[model samples]
Target chain A: MDSAISVHGLRKAYADVTAVAGLDLEVRKGEVFALLGPNGAGKTTTVEILEGYRRRDAGEVRVLGEDPGKAGAAWRARVGIVLQGTGEFDELTVAEVVRHFAGFYPTADDPDRVIARVGLTEKARSRTRTLSGGQKRRLDVALGIVGRPELLFLDEPTTGFDPEARREFWELIRDLASAGTTILLTTHYLDEAETLADRVGVIARGELVEVAPPSRLGDRHRAPATVAWRTAEGAVEATESETPTALVAELAARFGGEVPGLTVTRPTLEDVYLRMIGEKA
Target chain B: MIGLAQRQGALEIRQFLRSRESVVFTMAFPVIMILIFASIFTWDITPGVSFTQYFVTGMIATGLMTVGFQSLAIQIPIERDRGVLKRLRGTPMPPWVYFAGKVVMVAAIAVVEIVVLLAVSVGLFGLELPSTVGKWLTFGWVTLLGLTACTLCGIAFSSVSRTARGATATATPVALILQFISGVFFVFTDLPAWMQQVAAVFPLKWMCQGLRSVFLPDAFAAQEPAGSWELGKVALILAAWCAIGLVLCLRTFRWSLDR
Candidate 1:
């Protein structure tokens, strides 16, 4: 399929609450798409439907060229999932767990190589229950990719990682993306979404608000820039200016050399995201 | 699928073997109970049929029920609660393979419990082994059928609860009730006609009956209600339970704890 995933007019509800409402989304093959939203904004519900782990109340969803709702084992073999909670094989060592999961797929990658790729070579012999939260997440990734799936679904993959571990995880995701595997992940952390997603889709209140590259999210790059400068009295003055370049030149000429603390900047992705979700709320 | 079940079964076996709780409570519970019951009671229910010999076979059935029914009922729900079954559901492996592995593991544990209990009874309590090749063959079929029936029943009963604690509370009562009626810790002839009829409807009574046929003296069959070892009836009842349990499990089994 040209698109690894396609959902049109998708709708799902739990009793009285709607989890995914009239959602239309598509992810191209080999692209990293991050579904970002607030805590109860339907990100997980949407992803779970695509993973075929949960049934949709109403929708037309196709994953890997087959309807996820009725897809068979062959279709399932082509998809990998890292659920929100890392899967635990408490009694088995890391290598043993990896090898055991490897038997599930038709064509799997080398368990040792996948474990090393996730930077978990040292903890290979340790029991899964003994590992730290971050290490468990790495093992989750190892299992997700070992199946050599064409598409991978990561639900808050880095929720419990330390800074170094999170950075390493991003590198692993980047490598997978470069290898032409399609990824669709959801996260509470915007920086993770910004650093990894080629395109970010923000969902607010069961509806997708926007889908664009992180740099251009919420018209962030195109938003009015705020120009600030230190006054002669050591006080800072700032104004929202559409023509930040012209405004900076005016301030520089008036000050006779350079404007103090001059910062001509637009909003960060986090700023735009908060504003967008806040407006919708 | 068989290969997947082998790997799954191996992992289950490892976990079951390593756990100190299961070793002490599950593996040791039956043998310990048999030792206590054999020593405490020495009444001869029939001519030359001592309580020690009769109860040994009865405890074996009780032990099988504990592992196959109680253990399975609690373990499957706990696995579901812990998201182990849910995680496996996402994989390419068929869901039945996971259950097949459990069946194999429980059966293995059942066999171990049986062998240990039989060895002790024969070695210490002077319990008799099956005399004829025919009786040994009968013992083999009864063990296989009884073990399979109880395991499937456990899986089916696990569907009644969403949590492991709930399963234990629910499963324990039936097993306890079965113990009394099925003559695991009491004499079958001592119970009323209606109670014996109720016990016959369940697998435990048949399991006990089948074991009695093999271990008890041939003449002791006179104490039975049918006035004979109902080997054919025992096999039929257990096979029917397997069929009914398979249907119940397929209909009610849930991978996740949502329901």
Candidate 2:
């Protein structure tokens, strides 16, 4: 199927709180789709529903062409999930855990290769408890991909990683996507979505607010630019302009030379995201 | 499914062995208790049966409960809170395979625990082993039925506590209360009639009674509350509890506390 995951009018509530309210989404085969939202914005609730870990109150969900809520072991064999704060086998070595999970799938990848792919080859022989937080997360990724799943779900895979570690993890995700595995990622990091996702969907307050490529989110490319320059009095002057280039040219001519401290900037992805989510950047 | 359960069992045993504290505590606690009780209580319960001989059988029953019920109840909740069970549920492996693995692990440990208790009883306390094949058969069925009942009960009880510490608090008091009332620490006939009735409602009392039949002399069966070994009643009660435990496990078992 062209669509690896499809949901229509999904709804879930926890007693008095509505977690995912009438949300709809889709992820095409071989594409990395990122779900971006703040905490308690229904990102995890929606992903868990699609992962077959939670039941929806009202809607339909199909993962890999079968309804996840009623899917059996055969359907489970084709799906991989790396949940938040998981992969803690405190008494077992990394190699042991990875190899153990590989047995559950009909077509599994080599555990050692999976470890190496996640840059955890050196720590494979060490106990999982002994690994650093970042290394443990790498082991989590190794276990996630060992099943050779056609579709993978990564829920906040790099939440606690350092900048360099996050970059390394992004590379690992890119490699998986290149291997033709469809990935559904959830993250609040705007740069991460922009760098990895073919399309990013922003969920806010239990509903999807917008879905588009990062560059085109909220019409970012065509939004008015904020043109700022310094006057002779050493004060900053700024204005919103539809044509920043013309504004800069006019300012430069007015000054009889280059405009001092000139800067022309359209809204960034983060700015648009924060604005869409009703938060001040 | 069998292959996966076997692998899971092997992994579980390895992990259990690696945890030095749990290994020492689960296996050693019963052995230590048997040694202490044997030393302090040197009196005879009847004409030919010393207190050690009678107490050893009770201790065997207690050991089974410790491993099968207490350990699983305490450990499963910790695993649940740690997200171990949830992670396993996400895989292609069936849920029953996880429980089957637990049964395998518990059975292996229970066998070793029984052997060690028996050796201590015979070597140190001079407790006699069953001579007749019929008595041996009694020992086999009682141990198997009791272990299965306790293990299933433990899995069901695991959902009662939200955390490992809570599980320990809940499981320990319940186990201790049953041991006291079920004649593990006292003579069955010496206990009050109401207490005997309460213990009879639970499986541990029947397990202890069945084991006493195998380990104690036929003449000593006179001291039993029923004035006989009552092997049929013991088997029936334990089997009934096993059925009840299975139903509870099917109804109450949870993969995680969050759900």
RMSD of each: 1.9, 1.6
True contacts kept of 2: 0.56
In candidate 1, what are the lDDT values of residues B70-143, reduced to their tens digit? 98999888888877787787789888788878988998888899999899989988888988999999999998
Q: Which candidate tops lDDT?
A: 2
Candidate 2 C-alpha lDDT tens digits along A1-281: 69999889999999989998889898999999999998999998899888888888999899999999899999989999899988387999999999999998889999989988888888888989999888888887787889988999999899778899899999988988999999999987889999999999999988988999999999998899999999999999999999888998899899999889999888999999989888511
Fnat of all models, as shown: 0.50, 0.56
Give me the runs in candidate 2 sitting further than 4 Å from their true place.
A256-258, A279-281
On DockQ, the candidate that comes out on top is 2
Flag regions of model 1 displaced more than 4 Å: A229-236, A253-262, B192-194
Encode model 2's per-residue lDDT on B1-259: one tens digit a residue: 6788899999989899988998998899888988999899999877888988888899899989988999999999989888888788888988888898889999999999888998988999998899999999999999999999999999999989988899999999999999999999998888999999999999999999999999898988888888899999998999999999999999999887653
Which one wins on TM-score? 2
